[model samples]
Target: MPSLPPLLAKPVDLAPLWLVERLARLILSSVLKAHPDLFERLGDYRQTRYRFSPADLPLHFIVVPETRQLTVSRGHPPVADAAMTGPLVLLLGLLEGRCDADALFFSRDLSVTGDMEAMLALRNALDDSAIDLPSTLGTLAGPFSALVAGAARSIRSRALAERHATWN
Candidate 1:
């Protein structure tokens, strides 16, 4: 996805839920391919379901690692064994290797609830998984988009930091 300069000074629309899920699935697929024995260590967890929603943005996703499947939740019964909340961009940033997942958890930037075991399992698995993303889109719009996205992220982080400081 290419990001443009914030010329209008309005909220930048997030990529569709499906798009996010697709990217996540692609990253997970790569991990599973590289680590074929990961499931064997995970045991019989194919039935477990986990729901995810961004705390700082509006996006919801349900991921089941055992099956390597993920679905965009449609406001159904929130039936999940565990739930994780955080900024959508930050979560993506972690998967993209732009931020550290452990630091986010330790700093209270992300929150988890529901089945503690399941949450721990996910945290451990993802923290161990090797997921990488290229910030450049690999086309003519790549550099410009990357620059704009980087600038936007800087603004967001500063704003969040200021809010936290004032609240404290």
Candidate 2:
């Protein structure tokens, strides 16, 4: 099989912005539905926009706290209350609790700009929840839960491995 990065690069780069945005919205809504606590915790940032930029990708997402929406776009928004920038792997690691946020921030692996309070609140809320993306996705997959979970885990592992290989 082709390595993950090379296989994904072309398709992801070629995908239309509208398609990406719609997919992101669907995924975000599903995740939020599976974990209502996450939405509740984000209530403090109601009506605010939190942008997430995966430094290595030509994409970014704006997360709306009030509506629990995630909109993917090609460029960073002109104005956002808070923005988190990093490689996708690092961001996923932070979300999965696989690494420490402070360490990553101190080491400059990840960065947060704009509202510090909002960022901290988000970090805290994520840490407080037991969010396993693959598991959540599996549950959302209904009867195909196991298959979905397996595929998610496989993809995650490949992505992480690719990142590690590049670093080393």
Candidate 3:
């Protein structure tokens, strides 16, 4: 149920879409590079268009697993085979398999639409990947990888634990 604080969301909302998307692409690319077979686990669902809509952010992240393509936009995105909508933190938690997606869904904390099978496949894939986002992201820091990862991890822990109580 944790969400991005308004203060942090404001700057991101006001920031140029291209810049935000560039950063997003960097993150996705890093993950793809580290886990080349990420989508392969999806099987037939690999070709599905997945829309990850952050309920707390004014953006939609569309990912085509088969092509390993990701697109971030404020405007409308292409039709998706499935879509998941939730707070940014929740979405990130799902991405890292840090949250119990089924529990969240049944609790009405997460909203999933369209191809259920495909979505489930995507979730299974993600869970099996054992993705460590902070570590993967830290690799972007080069010589400062460890320090950056620690900071990111601390921030992530605080952000998820505090929910709307603090700005991370």
Candidate 4:
């Protein structure tokens, strides 16, 4: 999958941290609301701190499931029990179970560090979630949901086309 061009990502790097964090939290809250059980599978691992670092981006995202909290960081990403570093697209695909976590890790397209057990637990939870990211994001558009979804799906297809086809 293609990474966001450095030029395109520059604005995000320059944006205020609070703004980015707020937007991310909004999306996270929406997803949580849509699938309340999304993290239930994690059970005991739900309290673990996870960091998602997009290799193409300048900052990383921190998520605390038990607290239902999300934060963004530029210089400091905060402590995490586990961290996954990869392109934003691949990460999002994994969240929706549209990407095979094992394949990505084995192929070196993704990297996981810190607590392997916690990372695997998170993967298992995601695999069982049956999440549809475009649909979830589209709902944020309200009346334009269908249009937004179509565009998102189109973009997603394009992003996944050059790489693996298996949506594991």
Counted clashes in each candidate structure: 0, 0, 0, 0
Provide TM-scores for the models: 0.57, 0.81, 0.89, 0.91
Please provide, for model 3 over 48-152, each residue's C-alpha lDDT reduced to its tens digit, 9 standing for 90 to 100. Answer: 999999988889999998888888889665578899998887888888878788877887778999999999998988887778888987899999999989987
Clashing pairs in 3: none
Write one digit per residue (lDDT tens) for candidate 1, span 1-168.
Answer: 112224421242355557656765665565566666654555555557877776644456777767777776434436788877777655555444445555666777777778867666555555555543332221223558677556655654554454342110
Q: What's the best-to-worst order under lDDT?
A: 3, 4, 2, 1
Winner by TM-score: 4
Superposed Cα RMSD, model 4: 1.8
Model 4's alpha-carbon lDDT is: 0.83
Candidate 4 structure quality by residue, lDDT tens digits, 99-127:
88888898888999998998898888888
For model 3, the run of ten residues with the poorest summed lDDT: 159-168
Between candidates 3 and 4, the lDDT winner: 3
Instruction: Give the higher-lDDT candidate: 1 or 4.
Output: 4
Clashes of 4: 0
CA lDDT, candidate 2, residue 56:
70
* Model 3 regions more than 4 Å off: 76-78, 163-168
Task: Compute the lDDT of residue 34 as modeled in candidate 4.
Answer: 78
Model 3's TM-score against the true structure: 0.89
RMSD of 1: 6.7
- For each candidate in the order shown, give its overall lDDT on alpha carbons: 0.56, 0.73, 0.84, 0.83
